[model samples]
Target: MTSTPHHQPILDSPYVLDLFAGPGGLDVAAHVLDVPSLGIEWDRSACLTRYAAGLDTLHADVSAIRREAFESLPPEINVLAGGPPCQTYSVAGSGVGRKALDEVKGYIERLMAGDSDEKIDKELQKLSDPRTALVLEPLRYAIQATRSPNRGHRPYDVIVLEQVPAVQALWAHYALVLKNIGLPDGTKYQVKVGVLDTETYGVPQTRSRAVLIARRVGLGEPFLPEPTHQAYEAKGWNRGNGEAAALTHQPSLDEEITPEPVTRRGKSGGPLPWVSMRMALPGRRKPFLVRSNYGSSGHPGRRGVRTDQQPAATVTGRISRFVVFEHLDENVVYEGPRFSMNEAGMLQSFPPAYPWSGTAQAQQVGNAVPPLFGAHLLSAALGLPVPDPEALREPWVPATEEERAKLRSQGCGAADDCTARCPRPEDQAPPRSVSQKKKLSAG
Candidate 1:
């Protein structure tokens, strides 16, 4: 890789095109690693955020951009990445996709059996939730890039896809298809598919996602990246058979937990002591509790609670609904300030001042692939050295005013509703320094 003082790092195959890109999470990781990328996202809010963050974006649906358009694009696009919308497949949402799993598998089988896109799309229209078919868009793109006539006449050097763990089986099908397909040069792809725990990648949240990675045959065999941090396990809670047992109460403070040396190795030989909410959001004078909006153990009223010392529960679009409590003793509660956009973004491993624009900002943050985790995935896919987790953990500075201005000049800011959608400097909260003394409730 080569980089200049004023330019991004240029790799042998630097260009990436991310389909169904939500708020440029993977794009942020690509930028950090010096790989230039463009994201295609239909959500206006997500596109606005991407523009605010100075990311290359095309505000269009993945399906709308057909194979011809893809083939017409610059041939330097060697990497294809995406995390398709997972609402239908998510256990937290409607079980429409789960119910239609067999239908989807049949479609995949047809695609592998040389079925045409038009036929598959026609069959997909019969599904109850159309979004269920979006999961296969990545596979469609992969097939087109490799088999269809294009400028390069070569397959994408690397391909990465991610979605809810419910889509793991679908990814397995994708792995099979990709492995069997070859480029005009007879070079096939090496594929790996599995579910990864975000916490193991040093994210300050316990979210699991199914990921698929593919590389050209000649490139080193494709494999998932190894863990860089220990997975989060509740200190005093026992979880078995998907049931949470009674909690052995402990103080919700960093000092309350036994201090394990950071240098210590985990069972996976990764760093010891998983990152906690306290570590991710510093400068808090007191520990606090986050009460999730959703229920736990099939009890509607029993809201899930995680102390600052624990890694946060999986963040979702409903994050704003979660209540933060300065004090919670049984039923009694003292409500505290909720996490700011910056804090939420930080937990997702985005830069502190990643200019979040437009409405449903929390949803944008929640839907993102944690940049740190994305970095690891991209590194592994591109045959690059894994980045230092500690370096990624450090506070990230906000984009400079000049940089933001440049983005705006390049048509990155929200159009038509700039005043309402574009993020202001004051709107962003910088990472709190350790030396700064502030209450947990302080904004």
Candidate 2:
């Protein structure tokens, strides 16, 4: 695992160093904002995807970088961002981290008390899963950054971290620690931590993540990004009044499903409607219904259904198990298509032709922070203007026949197989219509 130069040069200022950077999710957002970033990821598959996406990546463990190479980071890198491994903390996975919360807090206290790395490492090994200890890596990096100014290493001015909603308590503890640890310049950090809904930020999927944003007190106060889209409310179910009703019946395959009316507004009075699956992946000839493999409300056999009219349910590594079918009358039942890798990526707000590589790409896409959401988060964290929701939802043109042929000639089967020469969404002409956009599938 080593560093490789990307097609684009790393910028000289406001650079980001991303830890546990799986498949360049935040990196994509940084690139869109013209902020250069270097991601440190240990997974070979994810690193391969990062290289394919033209994202600068150091293919190594975050712990290794923090310990053996912290001082080697470029002085221009002033932003620290990461989404640590969340499997242990995710509700969908084993609850080891949740059960071990107090122990983790103890480690945080020990670290703040100046415990030696060796002593912490010895205790961390005692966890049921060693990855549980990785969650503290970001805190370790933050603490190191605060103390490094005397050694010629510039302390990170902006720190952003995210994980499963289960980590909100951990982030709360982080806020307290960061505020007390004054920078060498005698300025403490302004910290904010909370849970954010991805759909509220215009991501097409309904996912919740715990986020922490910190900045030096001399900089502007830290605050969470405001919601730019209305939060999603699943049709036919009312949690507010404890009322339940059957979902509206499916329309015929040829009939279009009208979008639900939305009049919600934010403080800016400009928040848009929650983005739907149909809006996110337009150009389908037939209306489709997605049947989730997993059940809801303790019904192990009851698969959940989401109409094209709504935002997709939280995408998981097992998204391949989800089946998509043509919307038909209730009397009929048949096998339907599963979402293609590209379709899944788009549902997660990746560009139509984003170069996903290696195996477990669905997992990679599922684990990633939606780049669209990342853009808004980063914009707020950096005190930049938020990106327009309409602009973010603008459809991307699929690869042209000529582009596909050129890729084929280069011995590439798909855009993801190409590297530096991969065609970018901005490089292509906009499609004349949504139907025309589907002319060339990334599949």
Q: What are the per-residue Cα lDDT tens digits for candidate 2 across 139-182?
A: 78866775665446556788899887878898888788778855
| Per-prediction TM-score | 0.78, 0.77
TM-score of 2: 0.77
Best by TM-score: 1
Q: Which pairs, if any, clash in model 1?
A: none
Regions of candidate 1 where Cα sits further than 4 Å from its true position: 1-11, 90-96, 147-150, 181-187, 237-270, 295-303, 327-333, 390-443
lDDT tens readout by residue for model 1, 15-96:
8888888898899888777889988776767877876677877666577665336665567788989898766665444555
CA shift of 417, model 2, Å: 15
> For candidate 2, what is the total of clashing residue pairs?
0
- Which residue pairs in candidate 2 collide? none
Model 1 gets an lDDT of 0.69
Lowest-scoring 10 consecutive residues by lDDT in candidate 1?
1-10
